[model samples]
Target: MPKVTCHNICDAIAAAPLPDGMHTKLIGIDGCGGSGKSTLARQLAQDIGARVIPTDDFAAWDCPLEWHDRFMAQVIGPFQANQPARYQRYDWHSRTLANWITVPAGGTVIIEGVSAIRQLFRPALAYKIYVETPRAIRLARGLARDGADAWPMWQGWMAEEDAYVAAELPAKQADLVIDGTQPLAAR
Candidate 1:
């Protein structure tokens, strides 16, 4: 059940039954910053041969959740139709759309990001996963990865995630809750 948060959540997801009438199993990895959403997504992708779509491709420092329209139009819509999808990847350093990426049709997909399991995505998802970690740990991990110079940006992103959580209730609505603090090998 979703309430049973644990490191072995990936195993649980693999064993769970998917909904019928879909071309692919759509999985979402959602969590606050440094909660290991992307890490879990990567692990799941490797485990299931799924393409991991990092929400970072669409995210920006000032507007963390602004990629909703592009995601819907590019990824979700095409996936639902059993058609390949393409997205213009956003370059973090340049702060611009740099390159394009493609997702093949009829394959498993793991979408990881702050709002990966936002309400709008529920209808298409086979499994809505929420990764939970302590705020302090999350912030530390984020800062470590993005560097200390990006501390303020991380804070702003966390604040945006906080608001989204309040409004969307992603954790409560998820099909699985993962203990992201755990090691991937153990998980």
Candidate 2:
């Protein structure tokens, strides 16, 4: 297992060359709740000038896994054909679908969330990163981030996510596993 601070990951990503011959490369970042998947994805995107497509932005709050068809139509289809892709955004406040988003071509596209690396999307990804953090620390972080009022629901959601991942075994299939508990050191 290779352990890295967050800054080190960013440094490594900045030094890496963009994939050859492809207008867009999809990177999947999957992790347990509060394991810092989004944070790392954002940093990587900033370092590499890549587009960050958060899976949360596409998913329904109550049913996150049901957006695979949307992802296929929006992201995968466009990148595969070397065309710009667009998809609707989920409005968390109104609990309704929002305006469309256009994903431009010719850079890395990071799809990040709990199930971003699911079996359905794995084949299309150029690289897949799984983030690991101790359960207790994750729960504490989640509780702090979401608040006590939302902790119960968050815990339930995590349980459901865990069950799904257990059946799918996403970690075993990932290209890299990142230790997310530690902060990224300044390089």
Candidate 3:
């Protein structure tokens, strides 16, 4: 795999040809929990003037990866039609769909999180990136952010992520694989 550093990612994206008939450049950043997907998405969005639609906005403690349908209906549908998209974000604290967010069409939009690059969205994506991090490091990061009290829940979520990796092989399909162990700046 070729090295894709934060410094050069914008240049790389600019150089890659978009698929024919694609009006919007949809980029998917997929990784297990705490693998730095969100971090990369934010930085890349800033650099490229893109909007981010996190899968976490649709995910919950009970439903991890099954939120694809909601994403398809709310985001992809409108994006395909070259119109603005709106969706309710699932608040982790309230456990409800809170706050509607409207993302304008055109330019780049990043769909990021665990299972963000699932098969259903691949045909529309201009680029796919997967972040690979060790289980121990990811668990440590998750515990730190979500607190140790959510240990059991985190364990279950990690198991689901493992199953997704086994079945989907997202990394194998990625146009770029980022090493989560290294800081993007260092890369």
Number of the top-ranking candidate, with TM-score as the measure:
3
RMSD of each: 2.5, 2.6, 1.5
Q: What is candidate 2's lDDT per residue for 23-83, written digit by digit as tens?
A: 6778889988889898888877877778888888877548756788888899877787788
Clashing pairs in 2: 6-184, 7-184
| TM-scores for candidates 1 onward, in order | 0.90, 0.86, 0.95
Residues 87-184, candidate 3, lDDT per residue (tens digit)? 99999999999999999988999999999888888887888999999999999999999999989999889999999999999999998898998888
Top candidate, metric lDDT: 3
Instruction: Sort all candidates by lDDT, best to worst.
Output: 3, 1, 2
Sliding window of 10 residues with minimal summed lDDT for model 1: 1-10
lDDT of 1 by residue, 20-122 (tens): 6668678889999899888777766776678888889988997799889999999988888878879999999999999999889776788889899888888
Task: Output the TM-score of candidate 3.
Answer: 0.95
Query: lDDT value for candidate 1?
Result: 0.83
